[model samples]
Target: MSIGISMLFTFIVAFIGAKIGQKLHFPAPFMIGSMLAVMLFSVLTDTAYFPKEAKIIAQIVAGIFIGQKLTRSDVIHLKYVIKPTLLLLVILTLNTFIMGLAFSYFFHWNVLTGLLATTPGGLMDTTLIAADFDSEIHIVAIMQLVRSVGVLLLFPTWINLFTAEKAQEEPAEENVESTRKKQPLNKKHFLIVLFVGASGGLIGYFLGFPAGTLSLSLMFSALFKLRTNISAFPIQIRQFAQILAGSMVGSSFTREVAASLKTFFIPALLLIVVYLLISYLYAWINKRKDWLDFTSALFASCPAGATDIALISADYGVNMNSVAMIQIARLIHAVGIMPLLYQFVSFFL
Candidate 1:
């Protein structure tokens, strides 16, 4: 019952789940495994607990892990993605209002709640913002939860299934050799990387920007890596972050939230279908335009958490900078702009 004891128990369960996921070779295994395990525990016993601060810590670690991969060339190459990013924002905003209206009409839910529920923002950010409106917070939380978990479960497997042939065609020996040639990690440098990431995350958290904690931490970490060429961090740290994130998400499925799902099952299914269709459609368009490879475009277009997508992109060996840039753009829009748009639409309703 104590916070410390709950956290310890939660981590133990999460670690076991993560190991099982790894053994099964699940996509994004640590996150998916821990999330499923924790969700089951929470729903059954109602004792699972992960502190809110732990989620922030997960974001900080994830940011640092992704940031160290950036280079000057990647920064310069970002300009090439601006067009696709703008196109994505336009499509997503339009879809939000369209879907929100449909949900309101069919489910008889409040317009604002429907909008918040349908918005493609981070689960925590959207749910927190829903509190300010005359909306059903639980519905928003559940819908956003579905969107986050659905994307994490669906996209990686989908992308791999489609791209497996391409991966097989590549020179395996070269890839393995490149990975093996990386310099040994230094403990002091790793500590400094953590310090920079924490400082940036703190600044972002206090600044109160949308998705700022992870974004700023990543920006600072990338800048430090560019400046000093110290981009090494233990792989285990990244895996730990994934487990924490998964546990944080899983623990959100309290009994009350689960009970509400029956009433909103259709709406939840609709949400997943619509988002996936939109993601695939736009991803196809961008691939056709030759703006990015299909894999990168798919990750960029998917309306998932920016940090989550960035962290998973590494496993697929795609262009993470592009994916992160566009996902962050979508996140900022969903968090900062969609609420205002919904407020304006509410008056019309």
Candidate 2:
């Protein structure tokens, strides 16, 4: 078996470990259960079964899955979700910037590198930038890993908590009413998505925004025929797609980085709490307006893969639009805001 597949196995093992930990009533940090297993094996065994480069490739594949998730329907959902989406994308990115600045203030790391270092984006994205500044890839990677683990572990915990709080605040009768209205199914939505996705990608290629043009495929279609109707995107399929995507991405994180991750203790823990709050505050405000489901808003707002966020949102039976919206918003932010922020901070601050 190619070492590439080892990451897949490792991800599966970690996921199963997470489930088992929950079952065993172990208070282990959600990713802790699985991460420890990887750690223990590395300690005792000389074989580096899951090599480093192979893991990187797996994560790159996950990026492909994320890039494809932006079909037309998700964008249609975007209209309804735009408010929360803007709120979240800005909040989440700012959270990263602020948290990085705060962490730097306290920990004494490079400011620019700290932002990249503390980002909730997946491991590679954060580390790539961190590496640019020569700020310790291992530390950057660990911070992202902790953010990912915190996301998975904290999700259900927050779900149960929010559900209860939502219950207490809203009339019990309203909950009963909303649950019924939530149940409906559609497939046309998926077909519309395929067209926009395929056609949009083609247009993007022809038009050239570099990678941004790829999005233009949808941009063109959305610009003109947006009023064109379609079914809604399937919640389960989106989630499953994300799981496959996240697994591909998650698998790439192997023992090598985990072993060298000791210095990440502070940033990792800090990013975890900050990211959790980023999602929480986003949900808390939107929850007030009865926008979408709370946990889903949190899950969908994550700066990670679209598939991952959407799929997690699908868990609550809501479409992944909230997740997808935030993902797109961030990409937009990265394009629009990052350049300015980079210039301002680099020159002024």
Candidate 3:
């Protein structure tokens, strides 16, 4: 297909997918919906889909958003969760390694693909890195998708009962007024983000870091925020980035991957088991440490996005603030630290 036609088609399909996802209130619906829609389109047609700069921008946007999540309140909360968070980090890494071994031995998958699939990071982010590393996109995408959706659906329910009961026992805290007034956005803020994001991404790209563009964008944006009050780019940018990244990732699934998926069923199941085990262990630690309630900890520790966890917490009476903070710490460790750790470990493999 022509470039113009491909872009048009991608947007149309992504629009339809995103609409459905939004209606259902799925996590990162734009990304998930567009990815599934684009995957189906690629499988049914001969069109070659490409979004050359979209993925890079998406990474930058994601990194910036994540960096913004690290605030003073969040940092203070992390002090309480430092022990549990560190333990969870070790557990998550170990779990990924074990799952990687299982996939390599049982499914005849390469070590690279297996490890990437099991890495407890954001679905879109992991898949983007998988593509850069030349892994099987379909398997990695599906595995991450399933694990994410599973955590989204299953963990919240298990913790809901406890959270609901706890809510009944404790009186709701009074809403406190903010000391600082809200400020309006200005052009200066926009210019600052643009410059920082671009420069940081370039440094990361040239540095040859794994997911370097994202890492550098996150670091630079975060450090800038430390000195100033620059807010993240608008939510619309993150959504558009998701749509672009999802579409690209979905289109990457080839016929060979589809054919081999049947052989992957058992490995996928094993991956789910690994996720469940880690979630339960982390939840137990959260409860025992008194850092969070059972429901809050469960959702916080489950390998899903903080946004998804926060949404579920809002609906199910889990402590949204606590879950968000803990989940952010886990995400920073998983995405910022684990990729390099995986690369170092892969060197031995």
Candidate 4:
């Protein structure tokens, strides 16, 4: 098929999926729906493709939105998340090692491949590092996709179930109306955010931070907000980013990858089981030790992208800043620490 035709089909499906998702009030509906639509198409048709740059662009956009949420006050709150973040990192490392070993033994795959597949890092981050380790990229991609989708679906459910009361405690209508009327942003403010987003994204891409494009964009936006004033970005841009990210992730599951999943199903199931167990254990500990509410601790501990997790946490009225900081710290270590540790160990062994 022609590239033009492929692109057309992809967008058409993604648009329809996004509409359906929003109508149904799904969490990150555009992204979730687009991913599911693409995955379904790929599985049924035995073919799938999307622009390679889609995920990166989505990440940058997501970063901008997340960054815009930050202020100096949020930075002051960072100290609160530190203990839970550190504890969660330790838990993640132990969980990764044990689950990686178990998956390797069960699937008859190499230990490194198993580890990469089970790690809570973003899909692209793990896939690229898997390449360096000579692991099976296809397997790693599929497994990571499964891990992410699982987290996306489950996070909201857990929040709704456990945190509904807290969510219901929003300020009254008069207060919300008065607040909105008082602090409306003008065009110049949005332009500043856009400018900073582009600058931060470029700097992040070149410097090679973990999820750098998104992280840096967020950081730059936050700094801009701190120095000036808070402003609103078009919510539609975030939705578009979700669609792009969802489509990219969905299209990654080619027919070959779909066919291969059954071969590794048992291990995949075990990996999910262990991942959740570790996540919940850390969350429970945080709630008890750090004095965070259950919802806040849970969001802080979930193994997912910082931006994605933070957005969902906001929807549920969890402490968004805490979740964002902890998740970003996890991203840094997942992309930075774990890979380097493996590389150094590989040299000796």
Q: What is the C-alpha lDDT of each candidate?
A: 0.83, 0.53, 0.66, 0.74
Best candidate (score: lDDT) = 1
* Estimated TM-score for each candidate: 0.93, 0.63, 0.66, 0.88
User: In model 2, which residue pairs have backbone atoms overlapping below 3 Å?
Assistant: 55-252, 189-231, 200-217, 204-213, 239-311, 300-323
Model 4 C-alpha lDDT per residue in residues 122-206, reported as the tens digit of each score: 8878988999996788788888877776677666665566655764664553355457557755678778788888788879888
Show model 4 residue runs off by greater than 4 Å. Answer: 46-48, 166-185, 344-349
lDDT of 1 by residue, 1-349 (tens): 9988878888899999999998998877888889888888889988999987886787788788778889899999989998999989999888888888789789888888888888999888898899988898977888898778777778777777668775674457336535744757787898999999989988998998887888889899999999999876776787788898888878877787788778877888788878877878887888899888888888888877776677677666778878887888889999898888877866776
Error of 4 at 188 (Å): 3.3
Residue 334 lDDT in candidate 4 = 89
lDDT of 2: 0.53
Task: Write one digit per residue (lDDT tens) for candidate 2, span 62-138.
Answer: 22323344456666555778777767767766776788788777878767767766665545445655665535565
Query: Predicted candidate 3: what Cα RMSD to the true structure?
Result: 6.3
Query: Which is better, 1 or 3, measured by TM-score?
Result: 1
Ranking by TM-score: 1, 4, 3, 2
Report the alpha-carbon TM-score of model 4 versus the true structure.
0.88
